[model samples]
Target: MSELAGREVRFRNTDIALMLVAVLPALGVGGYGHLMLGIEILDKGEPDFSLFGVAKTLSAIVAALGIVLVGAQLRGRNATSIPPLVLRSLSGSMLFLLATALAVILVPRSLNHFVRELQPLSVLTEVVLVGALVFLVLSVSSAWRTGLGTLMGINGSVIHALLSGAVFLILMEETSWGQHWIGFGTPEAFKGNLQNETNLHNFYTYRFELVYYSTAVLAFVLLPAFWPKRLPQMLSQLGYYVPPTWFALFALPVCGLMYESWNIIPYQIWFFCGLLTAVVIGRNDTKLRMAALIQAALLMLSQLVFLTLGHNMEDGYELSEVREFFISVLIAGYALITWRRATGEGASASST
Candidate 1:
């Protein structure tokens, strides 16, 4: 009787309610895709099977998966295992980033003077990316101090170290070795580059952009949501950081808005609806629900501004900057959570 009662408490009618809410949006996704297809045919005199259209379709499919996953996960759990501080930090970061995006889109002229090369919004991208680097560095230190290297194995820190090095490389490449702010001229060798930037990424960007997007999606979204629970917990015990499924709340924007061509109302609606239902539903805590509501609203408003006005902006490249900023946020959050987990101060009260 006690076991049955506990099961009932964990999986309540509210869980079902949230699942239904999520299903409504999932149902609309297909019809919405068809409608967009019809509209494209009308406007272009044929269906758009171009690269951009294909990318958009792929994004829609993923968004649908996101909706379904969120619902399924919530239906099985009483409440999220995410720590209050971590959840709040993720929500606050999303709010701030999305708000900044909307402001930049609506008032491009205001930040024009502050913009640097590849930063159509402001220098905020660099600042945030640097912040991510700081967290990663701290994570490395925490891992060593906790003897994670010895605890897990001889090479336990291998993954963390490699990740930090990769991020550092990305930062240096993005900043063009400080040429963007320091106002230095590109060297003779790099002057021949297509963008006339000192960075090497520009030369092979098109080749690796897809790989970067795919890796981020897998690492931040799919792995957390779908991987077996035991695997992640085991990894955490072994000093490898595995993000909780709820991290998807913070990752949806990155997945939906990574590519400018894939940024549209369909993806935006999918993102907002998924986030709103996933965060607020199935949680008994009023404060957490209210916080989630506010963050969801900010995400929706940001998408609205982008779809309505920013989509038509002359420089599509600016959209990538937004994606990069969110990626930085993800990295920072992951590092913080990792550090906590490594030091036996896990963020979540409940086991993840």
Candidate 2:
């Protein structure tokens, strides 16, 4: 027991050390960009061959490393375990990196900016729509199998149907439902209040983004907490293969950083959703709960610090970048700890 505890401590210390190694240089580059270039690398969309560009390159590398680290940790391999899953994930990651590199090389510098701008929106639309379709299929299949009868005034199929519909709505809004694709002009009603002539999001109010993302937060993070069994059984099956950490990571980026909609509301939704996810995953475990609380506190504190300090800078930083950075680190930390605990629990269960 003492040996096991010591090993765990050593492993945790190593993980922390690696994280510091990963983050410090990135932060240094960010600070340098802020001080010299008057740009926040993590938030800027401009593609220039100046200090800003260097900062963007470095930041991207760091972000990729961070993602790889999370993938490694969530592969469920400890010191004694062979890392087949980790290797597989790493290979896929390498292929993605290779493709990105090829694109960068093949595309002209003038067109690179255009590619970068379109990539995020395209990726966001695809992910959301695909997820919605999956959920819709699962919900329909589950309802078909279980019969769409209500129990105690609550219907499982109805809840899932709502989730699917909401996600589809968000997807439509994101894509403007082929309005932009089809090259049609904005509607007259939307045109009068247009924030940006070309952008649909700016045409309407920020309320659109808020409602869509908030509904997502509620369905995926909050609703599951209130009634775990409310989720489709087919969807729940994913938990066996994909850890909650992946969802937390994916949602954190999309909720806060994906769209430039409202100020801080999207981030607040992400923050709470993360906290709720921690609570659900921790269950009745005191240590896990404590860790979750600490993570939440730290996330809030970091945001406060960023907002306070950000105003002093010339080109004020994006709050989303700050939110994303802190949440990613916190998610990685807690996910690793919870993963260890889960493995320990499983081992004990099997022994008993």
Candidate 3:
């Protein structure tokens, strides 16, 4: 009983600390970003460097807390709650809306409204506002069962942190300090990281980064924790090398279609991890693994489908985009079939 009591206290403290850490930085720096824009509103109305800098730093700190929370939560068993879930959604939404309102109110009405050209204040505003919104939506739609886990799901908040960091780097460029801070030409720097096939001027700055990261938070962070045993089982029966090849075939071309310059290395790493999970799960209870794999694949691939359509132009987009879609279907579908096949009586039903 004493041990049980200790565990309970620990959970409470961590939860409270994580929750506060998740929001404080956003609120604090978000306020500063607001102040910078306010400066623009008052004087001849130019962007304020000092205010923007302060805001970005704080915002990054807050988002890093969120990532830490998510990672820590993932290490435990599935645990999520209704109140925490709702609060997470609210936090993301409120931040996004507040930033949007400030941008409209503070930034001059005549500065060509270039999302790319917006000041640092404008950049941070965009990050928090959109970052929150993405997390909110992802959290609400999640299948996470624990309140804490749900709030910190991979798709829940970690992806938002990644997106927030990307935007921070881009905004820093507008100031001369972009070099001093981001190392200017470092491989991780905005220019090098975001320089994709599109050569988009604001690859890191684009609002799409918000959308991409939000979706990713769901895929990379959330899916693994919930993966079924059957998933890992199937892959093991067939052996390890095959699944990675299969996953790569599907993930790569889709990356091309999504066009967001996502870290391919990271994406591939996660895919193999998911596949391995499927194999492990499949070895014991094939049914559980198959179901988990399908759900995960659906959530991840479905998001990519939306993004691909939205980003790609209709003019010359090739039919090859369909290949990734098909490959996802193939891998996930096979798991379902094998699970049912191994389960005997459940085979046909599972396949259907």
Per-residue lDDT tens digits for candidate 1, residues 161-277, read 776788888778778889888889899889866689898877766545556655666576545543333323224353145466466555656654522444342433345444544
Candidate 2 accuracy as TM-score: 0.40
Runs of candidate 1 exceeding 4 Å displacement = 1-59, 62-84, 97-101, 108-115, 118-122, 149-154, 181-184, 232-239, 263-301, 311-314, 347-352
TM-scores for the candidates: 0.64, 0.40, 0.26
> Per-residue lDDT tens digits of candidate 2, residues 1-352?
1122222212246666665675566567667767986754324332244654455445545543543343233232112222354334323423432332333334323222332323643544445455545645465446545644233444545544554565455456545665645767876666655443344565544454455455545433333222222124444332221223323322322233221222222233344445444444344323234433444444344444333333333333233322223333332332332233233332221100
* Model 3 C-alpha lDDT per residue in residues 39-158, reported as the tens digit of each score: 211121111225554454345445544544443442222212223432343233234323333333344232223332234434444344444334333433231322221122243233
Ranking by TM-score: 1, 2, 3
Q: In order, what lDDT does every prediction score? A: 0.55, 0.39, 0.33
Query: Which of the two candidates, 1 or 3, achieves a greater TM-score against the reference?
Result: 1
Clashes of each: 0, 0, 31
Winner on TM-score between 1 and 2 is: 1
Q: After superposition, how far is residue 66 of candidate 3 from its true place, in Å?
A: 4.3
State which candidate, 2 or 3, has the greater lDDT: 2
lDDT comparing candidate 3 with the true structure: 0.33
Clashing pairs in 1: none
